[model samples]
Target: MGKLIENKWFLLLIIALTWGSSFILIKKSLLVFTPYEIGAIRVGVSGLLMAYIGIPALRKMSKKVLFWVILAGFFGNFFPMFLFPLAQTQVSSSLAGILDSLVPVFVLTFGFLFFGIRSRWIQFIGAIIGFIGAGSLMYFSEANREESQLFYAFLVVLATACYAVNALIIKEKLQDIPSLQLSSAVFSVWMVPSFIILVLSGFFQNFEASTPTYEALGYLGILTIMGTAVAMILYYKLIQNTSPVFASTVTYLLPLVAVIWGLLDGERFTIWYMVGGILILIGIYLIGKNKKPKLLS
Candidate 1:
């Protein structure tokens, strides 16, 4: 209905600003904390919050749904959460951002591969081109940087693949689960094993809890609750009413929002970003849609 579309767009606007600011917040947080610690705080807080909010619905999901939810938490959040920081330690944020743009492609491919769904070629190509435009922003002159860059790129791409995999799994296997409950359940399930390992490995003591660390934890909380949790609902609702092509437009905006936050954080800004963003936007604009085929082939 008109009400849902208007509501979803308004919610997405909040997601944009909040998720965009998360980049700057994460960058600032990384200054003092380890990546694992950040991931822990991020998912842990959001999971706890959502579990509280969606307690009844979460309790209602079948055990099979819980299994898929746990899988999503691990692949989508746990694995990627660790990979991103480890990879970023060696790779530039620009490179990581570009590589991470593979989310939609992976989502579509996984949907087709395991779920047996076919996507419209134009939408697929447009998403890929948008990724290329995002990727080009990361390219810079460096001697023989190709090998190392490619490795880090794979890690980033893998993270996005995890995301896409979760998307499909949720759509196929866990569609009966409520969005808010699913988001919280996934995070909470992942947080359990993560926290246990940190404690057993003695990484828990290393958490210094400095001012920036606390601030970063706060940002991660925001990222988990708003960006991951709330945005999950918004995106799910968007998919219900809008075509996948239009829904995927969120990908085009995410990186642009990241770039915008980078500028706001006083990072170097150049005309190339404008060009890349324009290309991505154009690609998204060209790929408008009114119908969504079943993700199952």
Candidate 2:
């Protein structure tokens, strides 16, 4: 069991499962809270929880390391935390999951462009295919006819870009830090800011005592503890143990889990959406093929 826990593949699977289900939690939480409230509470709560480990780690960081940590936290956690919930306001959870697969392609693109990393032609081709699929996904989306929904879908893509930047920062700059310490410290940076947002969003003033409110809060708790906090620890560990592109491959499994949850929730699932998702997955496969193989051990 302990050995399995340490295995990168196992950690990948666990993070996929946890994060995939997060969409539904967000959807459910949205039943009672605004996107701002959900995002603020999720980040603020997760940050507080992480502070237990992070405060100690904070004491040990030099200024340079702290800057990278805070940057990673912003791109990786803070913005995406809000963007996703906002996107899901108009987009389906499954579609949000599908769009997230763009992370690896963007990772490759940004890595090659800014980080002095070299890439093969095949990877470039994969990036093109991935963008085509993403464009098709958005174009064919039921939401495309509506300007607001289309804008929201783009937000999800933008969030994926943020995630890509975060991954590169972790791989290039913060690789030497312990994964848990790094994750805790990153999340800790947003703790106070998130709480400030929560308060400013009128979360306290609009408080209600109702069954739905309690249920939404419960979902938020799970989303924070499992989806944000625990999954982040494992995700950082995976990134530290493997390449960022490889770690982002968890998105391949993430959509499947999210689609299942969406279906169970009775959300619409169209054939075109599936076609778009398949294209994205194929693009990811080609991208993965371009990677020099890593031993699964």
Candidate 3:
């Protein structure tokens, strides 16, 4: 247990398993639930679960910090939660996961644009390259031949941009807070609203009427537990123990799991996907390799 706790590789594996599997879980949940319902349930259940265990950490946070937490919640957690499922309705989970791997690239791009942070030239070039790769993946895919479906794939890209913004906010504005505290507080602030949305969506009625709903809900439970709550805890620990770049390498592994799961689920795959995904991953690597600027004051 002690070695597992301290080993960076072990921590990385855990994150990859928890977060990487989340895309397919979203796919499974969407079998019965609407994107809005899935998003609300995710945030609501994870928020409650974290709050139950994270009370001590939450108490230590200042009220003044709640604003940033809420911002992160809405952008980083809430919006992406909704967007991924929505995108998956039209896009493959494999593609969604591949697009999600663009978060670090967007992080670099947004950081330099809005935060007045300086970045190396390679990072800028990488962002452009990453965009191109994403475009190719969306536009050229036989799996998403419909022009409208391709447009929906862009929604996943936009979600990554939101994730980038949230990452910057957390680093610059909420540096003093612990990871668990930040996650718990963000979820706590958003929890009630999300739950209210879920309830208003008439989820319970559908849930009772369908056996598949039970199986879908079971997948969602794992998604909430392993993907959101527990993964946040592990991610925070990784950040503490390693450089940000090292911790972010989980991005590289995520699509592999998503792609493998997609294949097993009988989703189509082609050499074109491999080409575009490689380019995006390369761009992400370059972005991470660039020296990071100081967190915003």
Candidate 4:
């Protein structure tokens, strides 16, 4: 038991479950609170939860990297925190999960555009194929070309793009900092703003109004603490202990988890979703694979 508990693979599985469960929690949270409130509470609570560990790093952090930390906090945590809830309002949790897989593609795109990172021909082709799957998802959903839902789907895509940029910032600028410290500091920086917005938005008043609100908030708390804080700590450790390719497999696992949960919860599932999801997964596989394929044990 102890050996499995300490295993990196075990830890990765836990992180995958926690993160993949987050969308359903978000859906539950939205039942009682506005998307803004949900986003605010999610970030604010996650920030505060990590602050204890972050304080040590906070004191020792160099000013040289503070700007990057702040930028990461905004693009990585702040924007996506709100964007997911807002986007989920219009898009199904399953579809959102499918689209979220596009992060690596956007990561490569933004990396190439802003950081001068070059990709092989296959990576470019993979990205194009992935976007076509995304298009199929949008065009074929039951909403059926409703501009508003499509707009929200675009928001989710934009949020993934935000995630891509955050990945670049972490790789380029904050690589030296320990992942825990960097994440803690980033969330800590944004904590104040999220709290301010949360308060101004009157979450407490709404929170006290009903039993169902408390139930939903409880789920949100789990999402904030387990999903954001603990999963991030484990993710950083996973990256440290394993190859990037191994750690990146979580990208493939998350959608499966999300889609399964969505199905159980009675969210719409369609044949197009299956087709689009397979294409996106294949595209991701091609993008991640090199000329020489590596075997796993």
Candidate 5:
């Protein structure tokens, strides 16, 4: 049992499952809480839970490191946290999950353009393919005619861009830090600010006690503890044990889990969705195909 827990494959599977389910959990939580409230609570609660580890890490962290950590936290965690819930309000959880597969594509694009990482022509083609898939998904969505819904889908795309930037930061700057310590410190940095936002969102004043409220709060709890905190820890551990590229392959499995959950929850799935999804996956495979795993410095 202990050995299984230490297995990298097991950890990867768990991360994929936890993160994939997070979209549905966000959907469930929105039944009672606003997107702002949900985002703030997720960060605040997860930050609080990690305080024990994060506080000490922060104390020992040099200001130089903290600067990058803070930047990473915002792009990686903060903005995406809010963008996703906002997008989910208009877009289905399944579609949001599908769009998230764009992270690798954006990472490749940003890496070449801004981070000075070189890419092959094939990778450029992959990026274009990825964009085409994303556009098609949005264009053929049930809400395609609705400008607001299309805008919301683009929000998810924007969140993926933020994630891509964060990924480059981690790879270029924070690779030397212990993964657990880095995650803890990042969460700790945003803890207070997030809670402040929670209060400003009127969560307390608007709070009520009812079965639906309790259920929504329960989903938020799971989203915080399992999806954000635990999944992040496991994801980082996977990076330490393997490579970022390998850890990121979790993206391949994540959409499948989300699609399953979305279907079970009665969300619509169309033929165009399948087509777009396949193109995105194929593009991702091409983007990652030429890259060999290099051990973190």
Candidate 6:
């Protein structure tokens, strides 16, 4: 983690593969489960899986630290877990990808507004520019021309804002916990509520997984472990290691990865898509550089 492994680009690559593909997985899972149902399972299963993996670290964490992890889970996973799937039902997977790029923008905004961190205008501008591309990509590639897409976009925005809140919470409240412990605890917390909702909602009462449904569940299961379980742990660690905006470079890279995955899978890309994607990339580059450049002493 010195000069070699812990580099920002390395972390970004990890995040790109993990979070970027999540929307694609979510699209598949939705072919069977309702958004609420998928939301419940993905978080519940991932939390349970990681809880076991992170046990020793969890035992080392203080109760005070434990609480922050729970809070992080609520904002980070719970809200977005439900929101993204619901949004995808109304929008294209590609649009979902672009919309998610706004997380860093909201993350930066929350950092300054709530945490009293000195505002970086350049960073904020970059964030906005990124969102501009993101929004355009989303708007143009929409699978549905219905008004529901607008509603879904708002929900995605809310989800991104939740990401911002989780960021500030992690920085100010959970700074003392080991990143792995924080990740485990938060994920574990998500399971309780998600399971409870799953039960109360009777989401699985019909429980019919056709072969394809079963395959979709398998995809979700893999996504739960890889995307939610493993990648989220890394994200928590990155937040601890760097500023939230720095951590949020994941947003920029992830969408491009999603775009590539979609394109390879035969999703069409138009001229507007290329133009919009380039704008988003430029915005990300600018926003990511806003952290005071570290000069070699």
Best by lDDT: 2
Q: Ranking under lDDT, best-scoring first?
A: 2, 5, 3, 4, 6, 1
lDDT of candidate 2 over 27-134, digit per residue (tens): 999999999999888889888988999989988999999999999999998999999999998888989988888898898888878787777778888889889988
Per-residue lDDT of candidate 1, residues 1-297 (tens digit): 547545757655655565555556566656766666666666665566666655565577688777787786677657777777656555545445544555666666566678777667776776677666656644531111655564554666678778677666666676766555666677667666667655654556776657766776676666667666676666655544443334555665577677666666666655655565555565555444315555442
Cα error, candidate 4, residue 190 (Å): 0.4
- In the predicted model 1, the residue pairs found to clash are 116-297, 117-297
Number of clashes found in candidate 6: 0
**lDDT tens readout by residue for model 4, 261-286:** 99999998999988888888777787
Backbone collision count in every prediction? 2, 0, 0, 0, 0, 0
Better of 3 and 5 by TM-score: 5
Report the lDDT tens digits of candidate 6 across residue range 80-160.
899989988876666667667776777666666666666556777777787787667656655435665567766776887
| Candidate 5 minimal-lDDT segment of 10 residues | 288-297
Query: In model 2, which range of ten residues has the least summed lDDT?
Result: 288-297
Cα TM-score per model: 0.78, 0.96, 0.91, 0.90, 0.94, 0.86
Among all candidates shown, the one with the greatest TM-score? 2
- Full-model lDDT, candidate 4: 0.79
What candidate 4 gets wrong by more than 4 Å, as runs, is 1-8, 143-148, 239-248, 291-297
124-209 in candidate 3: lDDT tens per residue? Answer: 88888888888889878753685446768988899888877877777667777767777887787788999998989988765675
The CA root-mean-square deviation of candidate 5, after full C-alpha superposition on the true structure, stands at 2.4
Off by over 4 Å in 1: 1-6, 53-59, 91-95, 127-148, 200-203, 236-245, 269-290, 294-297
Q: What lDDT score belongs to each candidate, Candidate 1 first?
A: 0.61, 0.89, 0.81, 0.79, 0.85, 0.76
